[model samples]
Target: MDDNLKKLIPFALKYKPNIIWNVVFNVLYALFSSLGFVMIIPVMNVLFGEEEKVTKLPTYNGIWELKTYLNDTLYYYVNYLTEQKGAAYALYLIISIIIIIFLLKNLFGFLGLQHLMKLKTGVLRDFREKMYAKIVDLPVSYYSEKRKGDVMARILGDVNEVQNSFFAVLELIVKEPLTIIITLGIMFSISWKLTLFVFIFIPISGLIISKIGKSLKSQSARAQQENGYMISVVEETLTGLKVVKGYNAETYFKNLFTASVNRLYILTNKIGKKHNLASPMSEFLGIATIAVLLIYGGTLVLQDGSLSGGAFIGYIGMAYNILTPAKAISKASYQVKNGSAAAERVFEIIETPNVIRDTEKSIAINSFNDKIQLKNITFSYDGEQNVLKNFSLDIPKGKTVALVGQSGSGKSTIANLLMRFYDVENGTITLNGTNIKDIQLFALREQLGLVTQDSIMFNGSIADNVRIGKLNATDEDVIAALKIANAYEFVQHLPDGINTNIGDGGGKLSGGQKQRISIARAVLKNPPIMVLDEATSALDTESERLVQDALEKMMQNRTSVVIAHRLSTIQKADVIVVMNRGEIAEQGTHDELLAKNGTYAKLVSLQSFES
Candidate 1:
């Protein structure tokens, strides 16, 4: 088995009950199918009256003579029935028995299929769930390097590809080989000489089929990669549709999208062209091998006269039966290769280790005390260039220590490191006196609330979005939080109040409304610490006034780290720290900073001039 294909074994074992029962039914189906062919000779014999006449009942025989004994016994009954009743009666009985055998064959085949459906769908279902669960826990840093659409494609398209090719390979591997083996055993019984001749071509056909699919996995990998890239482009275009339209870059994106799809089209065509060969090559080989067998077996029947005519015809039919499974196995070989490519991609995401996971000795904290401190932290998003360099600060309890800096000055990185969104390269962030990494991640997060510039929202009601902070918060709690954030008046005017659908990312609401709702969410949680990253920078003057008012109310008596792009928002902060490059250039109270007449004083001047 390919290494990637082996990953499926654990998931397959998850449905062990399904596998065991499916194999049982498949074994029965294979038995009845071969037996159906075996009965063909007797049917032809009874129909043509070529059954050997027996004078008396055949004697009981050992297992070695079972075939001859059974044949004699069957002929004796037929002769007796023909003499007593009629030839038509004996013929009807033989035909009816053949029908029953075939019926049982089909019945078991269907039963096997029922269990197969469960195994296929069950494995894929668990696999998709597992991928989604893992993706959710992956550190936020992982998303920075990956495209949204590519991740979405892995969960959706690649999983579906596994369903089509990999799970279907399961059935082909089990049932097809069993059918071929049983049918070959029957053929050998009629004439070992002819079955030996048939065996000569089996490996040859397998070789041709294997050779056809040798490079399919690589080609398929390229195709799926291109497909993921195309999806990433589509995702980027949708996410930045406003910018794309405002800048009139529709043609640029469309042309870029078309180029990716065109590459995918060519790669898939290469795979399909190679994949298409397996069926025709195996089919032609099957018929050609059969033709050679017919002549060899015909010569034996006519000149050698060792094999009976009825048995010869039946053997030929069995040979043809082998062809069906041979064809299926041949095709499946290619599909397994193709599916292996998708499996590799799926497992890539599943096997990635999360760098931000909690340690074995981690402890949960219920409340925060004293202060949160970042001590001599050095960090970088990209490994080569530092984003924060020995950057240290102290945020005391109930104090709003605001971060004021230009873009890329590491203000937001400080917030991220404090919240454990990204761990610092060389320092400790402690909640109270304990290292935040030593605390249970969920517990650490529970003690803090974050409101980012984007105002992330799910497609749910106003109350539902707020409940994300505290899942059990009642409608009254939601309303109280909203009122504290100065958002309840507008929410009350809506048709459904707090129950109204927010739409995607609260598209139905204005920028200020979403920001206030986010503040209300943090207020409802009532965490000991809050981190607000440019929470009102994107708003108009009026919207900023409303959102800023909400932020102030939410931060009351709570330890807060506010990263402010607009210096005006942080003029009253307990302390304002101005960042330069990756380090803190200065830190003091607003009055003390103004007295220094340095970076903080200049930032105030710039904002005043812009206003």
Candidate 2:
């Protein structure tokens, strides 16, 4: 077995009970199927009147001669019935028995398929759930380097491929092989010489099938990758549709999307050709083997008379039966190959070690106290070019600290590090004297509320969106929080008030309305610490005033770190720290900072002129 297959064993073992029942059904089906073919021999004997005329009924025999005794008894009864009643009745009875055997065969086949379906769907659900959990648990930085559409393809398309291929593997490993074995056994009983001839061609067909499967995995892997790229193009196009149209770059994007799809089209065509080749090659080989059997078996029956005509014909029926299973196995080989590639992609995500995780000795933080202190922290999103170089700051409890800097000056990095969104390369960020790394991740996050420039909203009711901050918040609590954020009046005027469905990302509301909703979410959480990254930068004058008022109310008596692009928003901050090129240039109250005539004063002057 390949390593990818080995990794999937546990998931397969999860459905062991169903698989065991599937095997039992398959065994029963194969038995009935072989019996259905064996019944042909008796029909041939009756039609040719070749059955022996019995003088007396066969006596009971020991187990060694049981086969002989059973055959003799069956022939004696048929002969007696033909003489006493009619040959038509005997023929009718034989045909009815064949029909019953065939019905049982098909019935067991359906039962086995049902078991397989249960296992397949269950494993798919488990696999997808595992991947989704891992994706959610990974650090925010992981997504910075990955495309959303690519991740989506892995979670959706790759998982679907794995499901199909894995089911093929199950069929190949259990049902098809069992059918071939049972059918071969019956064929051997009819004539071992012809069965030996069949074996000679078996290895040849297997070699050809194995060669076909080898190329499919690599091609399948390429196709899947290309599919991810194509999906990413579509995702980017939708996300940037306004820009695409505003810049008149539609043709450029369309051409790029078309190129990606064309590559995928070519790759999939190759995969399909290789994958579809298995069935025909195996079928042809099977037919060639059957042709050989005809000449060899015909010579035996005509010249030597060692094998009877009826037995020869029954052997041919069993021989042809092997072809169906052979074809299925051949097809399954390609599916397993394709599935193996998909397994590698899926397990790669599942087995990835989360770079950010709480340690065994991590402490749980029940409440915020004292302050959050970032002491001489050095960090980077990538390995090179530090975003924060030996940066240090102190945010005391119940004090509003504003971070003012140009873009890329590491203002937001401080908030991310405090929240443990990314760990520092050096130094420690402590909450109330305990290192944030040493604190439980969820527990630490529970103590802080975040509101970014872009108000992130789900396609849910206004109340539900606010309740995300506190899962069990009551309607009264939601209303109170909305009032605190100054969002109550607008929310009340909406069609369903708090119950109205906010279209994707609250697109139905104005910019100010969405920002207030976010503030309401933070207020509902009622965390001791809050981080507002440019909470009102994108708003018009009116919207900014409303959102700024909500922020001021939310920040009252709460330990807050506010990163401000517009200096007017932070004029009343208890302490304003101006950063320059990844290092703090100055820190003081707004009026006190103006006395220094330094970086803080220059930024305030530029923003005042722009306004």
lDDT of 2 by residue, 327-361 (tens): 99888788788888888888877888898998899
Worst 10 residues of 2 by lDDT: 602-611
Give the Å error, residue 361, model 2. Answer: 1.0
- The TM-score that candidate 1 achieves is 0.96
lDDT of 1 at 410: 91
lDDT of 2: 0.88
Clashing pairs in model 1, backbone N/Cα/C closer than 3 A: none
Q: Where is model 1 poorest over a 10-residue stretch in terms of lDDT? A: 602-611
Best candidate, lDDT-wise? 2
Please give the CA lDDT of all the candidate structures: 0.87, 0.88
Off by over 4 Å in 1: 55-65, 609-611
TM-score of each: 0.96, 0.97
lDDT of 1 by residue, 253-339 (tens): 999999998999899889888778878888899899889889998998899988777788889889988988888888778888878
